[model samples]
Target: MELPTALYLPGDDGGFTATPLTIGPWDVTLQHAGPPAALLLREAERVSGIEGGQTVRLAYDICGPVPVGPVRVRGSVVRPGRRVELVETVLEVGERPLMRLSAWRMRTRADDPAAAVARDAEPHPAPLEPAGSRPEVPAFFTTDVAYHRALEWRFAEGSFNAPGPATAWTRTRSELVAGEPMTPLQHLLVMTDAASGISAALDWNTATFANVDLGVALHRPPRGEWLGMAARTVLGGTGAAQCFAVLFDEAGPIGRSSQSLFVEPRAQA
Candidate 1:
């Protein structure tokens, strides 16, 4: 099986193009919020020019359905500074803008020894067991390069098809761009937008939960390739919901992510 994560095509004009591997929730023809979000983050980090700093927060707005194939990407520094830098990246198909993303990069600081000793913390969850085979999922939800094939998912608390909160360990076995190196932040961000799928509170056969926006905040730079997510979806009566994922790596708690979801019945294509 081929990897599903690498979706950026090298462009002749020194830019990158979108590929079908970016496909997401709505359908196969559209790209997922995670891949584009990761792509934007990659560019943001590049343009920010703040080396040794970490991404403190990332906010992405899905302006419309991000179509598959050959979308253009542009990254720029909106507010530049030494301690804090704001960067933005936009993905467009022709003249139509599909998604816009902004990120805040902050400088790293030496930790206070006293602060480290003052707080008590829980131990990391037990390592997940080997996931022998990919679980069976509905055909409508499956893509040409399935998520299971791209990422090594060792589920500890919940399942993809089940309707409830979930906790799982995810490690990237695939690349974000074909030949480009994916940073730790990019790796984490690639799965941030999948909180809805990791923990679906709604039925897949009858309902839809489309996240229009994603907000991610990291307390410290993540280490190791494996990332863990404890995600849940909370729905309200006003046709809105939220998917929150507490992120982790082998070391300890790293950060958290939030997605503003537009919950509704699945619309026929």
Candidate 2:
């Protein structure tokens, strides 16, 4: 058999929705790399035709299996208005509904004063290394990129061998999703939610549990694409664990993300 690759989904052709990228427990298919939370928003932005960096608020009522391959995504403004638009995006495999994403966005004013808030706890990002020295197949990600050609990934502090609270970076190998100026919120959607498996490795065994859910709230829109995330574990054990994180780039702190994990014992040797 051939090796797996870090694959990217096609935007215009419904990236990985063309087939069953992966289907496993607490495991996301390769076609769907990031969590459903923020991805739902980003996908909604494109399939639904919302402008980039728009001040958008979106929510998900994830019910059925989020299938992959030749998937069709359709979206529109629910409560269309001059200042803001309520948009929705749906994922389909042929004629079946796999997932639904909804969003709310608004136009803002210039020269607005920034709000006062406590700073993010993550420190300055560590140096980034070359991404070519590791295994090509995705690690821990349920969706094996056996067929897709996605992006390359570089870990800032941790790899599969390194310990907890590491930072990593990824981008399209062939620019499937790029060129559009992204906000910190959008970056958070991709990088911040990748804490579960890595967190478990840093604190305990190699793969102790998987994430139940992850949530992120942006105080302001993102300023650049060089996204950074500092992930650390705050709690664990007894079938539950929590991870805290700080996200940013050269400018300053962007926002934060929290991940909850459901624990299972290490497989008997």
Candidate 3:
């Protein structure tokens, strides 16, 4: 099968058309949360009047399944300040909103002494090299899924079939939008939503653990195309589940990501 060129194609009227590259393993007609989350962040950063600022926190709420078609993006700065600001972005399919993202942008401190303190305090070692890692796709994913084909994955720790924590390095082969290079932040956002799937604690064929919300906090900007995630999922007896991952770059740890899941048994086929 021929792969899509990019996850989205831009329109003249400032809208975007989702490509097959955005398809998730769960549904072919709907988009994976990764692409839409990244798209929301892309628009969030474009809101004017936020100068010399960087997004430190992102909270994305998935309202519903995002359809694979035209989408309208809207962004605004809700709470503005010189040193800090709050921005919000929403993705809509026609008149229905599918996803919303709220971000906190803070002023950059180039010479902050806290940098040194954090460097010394949090000394997370790098994971195994992607080149030498195993390139294995889980049985849960069909070979025809575009999201799996669009990303290169190298497992450094647990396998996808293993019912526990896993560490893997991942990167997208396609750009976020046609003709536009994806930013580092965009790249990170695109992969953050997969934390639960990678670190699933239950069998994919038996259970459905879909994340309703994703939260990310970044201490520093990610560098390089390859991103690593050391992730795990926790399921509670009360029908609540959550996934956590420490975001990494080639250099080292950059941030943390989390997802709140809505767990249920898979429908009998």
- Residue-level lDDT of model 1, residues 1-269, one tens digit each, is 54544667778876676666666756778777787888888778778778877888888999998777777778898998988888898978888878899888888889767755542264554245335323343344556564444566677777877889877777777788887766778878877788888788887777888889999888777777777778999998789998888888876677788999898897755
Which candidate has the top score in lDDT? 3
Sliding window of 10 residues with minimal summed lDDT for model 2: 16-25
Local accuracy of candidate 2 as per-residue lDDT tens digits, 1-269: 33322222446654443323223334344234343344456566654433443643444444455544344557766777667677776656667766665666766556343342233444445464334333333344444542222334556676544556666554433222334443345545655555553444543444465555555555456554456566777555467778777656554555666767666666645
Lowest-sum lDDT 10-residue window in model 1: 129-138
Better of 1 and 2 by lDDT: 1
Regions more than 4 Å wrong, model 1: 3-5, 111-120, 125-140
| lDDT ranking of the models | 3, 1, 2
Clashes of 2: 19
Task: Choose 1 or 3, whichever is better by TM-score.
Answer: 3
Q: How displaced is residue 79 in candidate 3, in Å? A: 0.7
TM-score of each: 0.89, 0.62, 0.93
Off by over 4 Å in 3: 111-121
lDDT of each candidate versus the true structure: 0.76, 0.50, 0.86
Q: CA lDDT of 174 in candidate 2?
A: 27
